[model samples]
Target: MLLDKSVNHDEVLLRTLAGRNFYASIQTVVKQKSDGQLLLYGIIEDISERKHAEQVINELNETLMKRAQELESVNKELEAFSYSVSHDLRAPLRALDGFSRILLDEYQDRLDDKAKDRLSRIRKAAQTMSGLIDDLLQLSRITRVELTVKPVNLSQLATDIIVELQKEASEHQVSCIIQDNVTALGDAKLLRIVLVNLLGNAWKFTRNTDQAVIEFGVRSSETESTTIYYVRDNGAGFDMAYADKLFKAFQRLHSANEFPGTGIGLATVYRIILKHSGRIWAQSEIGQGACFYFTLGK
Candidate 1:
């Protein structure tokens, strides 16, 4: 075949006489000498190790892809279940709140102080549960929503959220210092939610302080390429022992009586940051202030 110029180079899987399988790369060369004699030369290289390595890598890739698909499917099922349960609970909550309100309105003259207070408590509990359900739905939506990534002005978002918080709690005085031009690449709407919860918590926890100071700023890391954004507040901070539970649903370091919240805000923030492939953490002491730091992944 080499003399006839039928084949120049080829790769083949061959089996030895002992039944051992291997791969080879073969190259053929034909030359004519001045003495009019033809010379045929052939080179064969054993490529079995490289071929085996490639096969193993391909198999591993396939397995990883399958696992990733399975995980995604399970996550979708759990999200659907959460949405259905939350939606179902809202109806009963609404009924409870409505009936309690009706009783308070119609039977106010007939009911005593204790009875009225009990009804009001029932109404309040139901309302709080309803709010929690709403927050759960929002968290679920955050997980499922498609991210529209773009340049987001986080400083502007923090300022806007602070303005809204001030309008709601006009009596509480808070000094907010927002850094200028602190921008990031993320979903603008979702990042806005992050600021809303962080700044709102700062504002809420600082209500009792004589001079409340909340700061939103960014700092560059010398060791890493990511920028660290932070929300710091001189307010009712929390114990560091429970910091690990800060991002879980229904987990609160402070009691509802002390700081009125559904406890899902941080969880929602955590989910949004995870969706952006980022990390969030907090530092605090019992009486000292709290500072939340986060890095958005590139």
Candidate 2:
């Protein structure tokens, strides 16, 4: 160049004679010599590695976005299926229940003892199926609901649930020990469901025991910032071998006759804990009591 000026070009891509790509920073300067001739200077620096890294990052981000979209589509489809099945089955379930009840009531004289028993069993199965459907809808709805997190007095909530449980089954004589000032930051309604399921399971399991003692408290952890809350009971605890199946949908460790349940409660609890970005686990042995521990948030 024949100018007395300086210019800079940053991170310019250059190609070699062999067709390989490289990145470089270029600068140019012009100077006038005493002989009235102009001199030009240029400097170049390679930045090929940084350019290649940026390209890889861009590609990774694009792939992640596509995968996220695909997952969202799958979730929407599953939610739609859950909702449709729940809504559609309710009508037929009600019809079955109603018809069976009517037959038992109206045809009592015409039907024999075995026929009446069969009708009763049919009605019970229908009711159980209806309960299962309701639980499924609840599990599906929990994901869609907006979470309103605030400082919730979990101690009070536990006491209230115990009160309701006692009122429902006043026949059970069990003692409950709830720790005072036990609070957590979470959605009140969702957290209440968690407690209801856990505490209810405790009460149910302790039914066969001579003395039932249920407790709710927080576990202090020296290494963790979050407090671990737990529900403990002296009842018919489950075997640790089947612990892995505890939180799966419709997985029951006990027979329906021994313990009447839909098996969706723990699965719902698992989903709720996951939504809050927390963890849950249980410790138990056969004939020993079970203790369920969980964290709400990070």
Best by lDDT: 2
Output the TM-score of candidate 1.
0.76
lDDT of 1 by residue, 178-235 (tens): 9999999999999998998999898888878889999999966798788999999999
Model 2 lDDT vs. the true structure?
0.92
Q: Write the per-residue lDDT of candidate 2 for residues 162-246, one digit (tens) a residue.
A: 9999999999999999999999889999999999999999999999988899999999789988889999998999999999999
Off by over 4 Å in 2: 10-15, 19-25, 45-53, 220-225
TM-score of each: 0.76, 0.85
What is each predicted model's overall lDDT from 0 to 1?
0.89, 0.92
RMSD of 1: 4.0
Clashes of each: 0, 0
Error of 1 at 34 (Å): 23
